[model samples]
Target: MVLGGDFNTSRPELLAPIAQIARECDGRSYAPGDASQEVTHYTYVTAPGPAYGTYTSSKLDYLYSTDDFTGCDSWTQKADQADYRATTVPTGVSDHAPLYGYTCGGPRLSWDMHGSVDGVVADCSAYDNNGSTLGAVEWSAADGGAAVFGGTGHLATPTPPVDSRLSLSVTAWVKIAANAPTGAIAALDGSRISGFILWYEADGATWRFGMPVADADGWNVDRVIPTVPAVAGKWTHLVATYDAVSGQMALYADGALLGTAQHTSVWKAAGAFTVGRDLVNGRPNAFFHGSIRDVRLYDYPLAPAQAADPTL
Candidate 1:
């Protein structure tokens, strides 16, 4: 269900097999970033026998998955602690340490704007320099009769009373208009206001999620669920959920699981929340350029069926 490698090239040839497996299993590939960004760099370091000469480095690890199996819940590249003078290691076997397991879990799902909106509050009475606006809109008649977000706009609201529970899922039925600028994100932030944030971005067509890293200062973390360009002007389902016990975060596109991350108790009770843009800076820089509907948030992480099930 899971495959990883260090493909030296950035073309499909290196990733085609992984993609095939995902397609056959009804799953998808989850890379940290797209090929265009060239996040996958190849390098290695050779220290001069404690003499401390120039060290070599390379990017050689990648994670892939089949459609039947949900992708990894979390992943990380290893670095030398001693090289950075952060810690001491007994053996200097290799410049790069082997990849290690950090966290694990299946994909999670929840509704963002489903059912009653009693406890939810929307703050859209403002506009930014990019002509982006935020406000709550009712779902259109064509969209399964759910009162979802309307217009090519973005908005942020506080987690309603119904979402006070610890572990929960969030789902949104979204449509990105044709030729919309990339770098758009739809996210949910923890109560810390600065600690942990879970978000998805349509980076020029590739979909990615931003997650937290352990023991790292600031919000240093990884991005998962890398893929080809997302079709413009089409309805797609995006879901993210966290299991407090397992400390896993999963991302689902449409009805298929894409990627997962591992973490423990990432979400705290901070009472801070946002959508459409990165809220850490308190601005709408990466604004979403599409229509969102059926935004639902739940108190518990939804099962795969609950997330992809149309009946819900």
Candidate 2:
């Protein structure tokens, strides 16, 4: 979606050039219409100590949406990443307020793994969200060709194309090599905080759809785990979904509904949706030790019935 803002005016209508830019780009933003007010803003925080002080400001934030954005969800303020924006908004509370737009419609990012040893994976979607392999990650002939990660490698996408705070679904054909303890199957998270993660727990041998309900940290994660065991060396269709309006998440393994869980608040972990690994608090945590194929990412939550068969 097109994001435009941080201009020298209060009225969006008055901003002719910005509006034109949005029109030309064919995207939307998280701009509000209350008029003459910009409540959620990005900030530049200062050192927090005896001489700590946060009393400066810069331009306003740009959080608008595209014309085609279906049911544009709310634009949330960005939070401080490792206290980077420096911290604290003008209100003197909270860390950061990022503007996120949920472009709910159809598939936004897709990867059809078709080759072995591919360095640059193509994004089959209309948007150019191509991913690249990092470290020891490689495209293997397993599962009709897929990316295999060996603990210390992963596939990284550019700036996230879909918003993490909105209704969304992620699906893939996964093959577990062996159970270690835990590893991120796939996820969307911040630089040091996670937003949502589709992971596995060897202790329970279950596939879980997790979200940090209480906070953006890793420990506060709430999950909806499937009873099905992630049989090692076998391919299983895995699906994880989140309903933004309801604050709920669901998981499915091989077309069967695992279960559901509730997360009443918008747990913010705005960052690139990744493959083969999920990160939090600047920790490696765990990388997916398996092969992931036919990864499809949709902007809206998929119903239980539809989860059985996702269109590539």
Candidate 3:
């Protein structure tokens, strides 16, 4: 299998999952061979500031694979500018360079199947989507499921591509097989307009929504949304929202409002977005080990009724 994109962090903690998957599939790895060869560093950097310069450059993109197949021989990073100096692109485009590669999988196959979406039958199945491997995450829909990560894992400072502005509502249907660790943040971080993040502390089962504060060393906290009394095996819907203007944050569970907080400003828009961990201290830590599905992000805050509707 061939995979490429901004893997975002080089920390061992966040790379563990990708490591495990590589071990299982016998995949070797290669990063930009040198700084001069680095195609794109720092996926998230907002314009118009000096500290902005502090958060400069690193080879955040990568490509990896299991035992090299016959047709899949090499990969390359395609830079938009030949000299590697950053420049503008078309609308709705990210500054990060794109990754191109060749893979040796057999001739493609096709078929049709139906499944329930809002209780209505739809045509789709596992084979519809191809798969790839990231640092530690091996994703494949054809392996009898949509996407599977190798064991519970962590990530550090994983940011989205530069020029990618994500304004959306996120809904996750999660089944927690193992209790998460304290300070587990499942939201966006490390960006100028930091995205939303949801975290829970195992010690108290107290949940909080973390958003950016206008000045440094400040974080606005919403009221804590307590988790349901722990049950060994159970599924839950954990939702959060951020109104760009109000800098207001809210949390909900199974349709009930849990807590809210107010900030002077919303998250800065340029930086890497991360899932299952935080991008702090120049790396990712506080990983979450659980089953997460139907992870959706919306540009606007979702209404209580809309968030609660079971059919969604």
Task: Encode model 2's per-residue lDDT on 156-252: one tens digit a residue.
Answer: 6877766777777899888888755678888886767667788878878888888776444447777886676778888888888887766778888
Candidate 2 global CA lDDT score: 0.67
Candidate 1 TM-score to native: 0.47
The true-versus-predicted C-alpha distance at residue 273 of model 3, in Å, is 2.8
Tens digits of lDDT, candidate 3, 1-312: 545667776443565666555421112222112112344543334565654423354445655555332111112243322222244452223446554333323212111111123322221222222111223433334413222233444332223321112223455554444555554435555533244456655676655666554313334433345555433235566677655444456777778777777644433535434445544443454555554444444444666786796433
lDDT of 1 by residue, 1-312 (tens): 665555554455556756766531112222322121223332323454664533444445455544232222222134332444433562344434343221223222223333234434332222110111355444455655433433344545444322222455656666775666653445544432223333434455655555554323355654455554567777777776666555567777776877787654343334334445544443434555656555555445667877686433
Which model scores highest in TM-score? 2
Local accuracy by lDDT, each model: 0.47, 0.67, 0.44
Task: Give the number of the best model, judged by lDDT.
Answer: 2
Q: Deviation in angstroms for 302 in model 3?
A: 0.3
Candidate scoring better on lDDT of 2 and 3: 2
Candidate 3 residues lying further than 4 Å off, grouped into runs, are 1-133, 138-167, 183-185, 191-194, 214-232, 310-312
RMSD of each: 15.2, 12.6, 19.6
Error of 2 at 133 (Å): 1.2
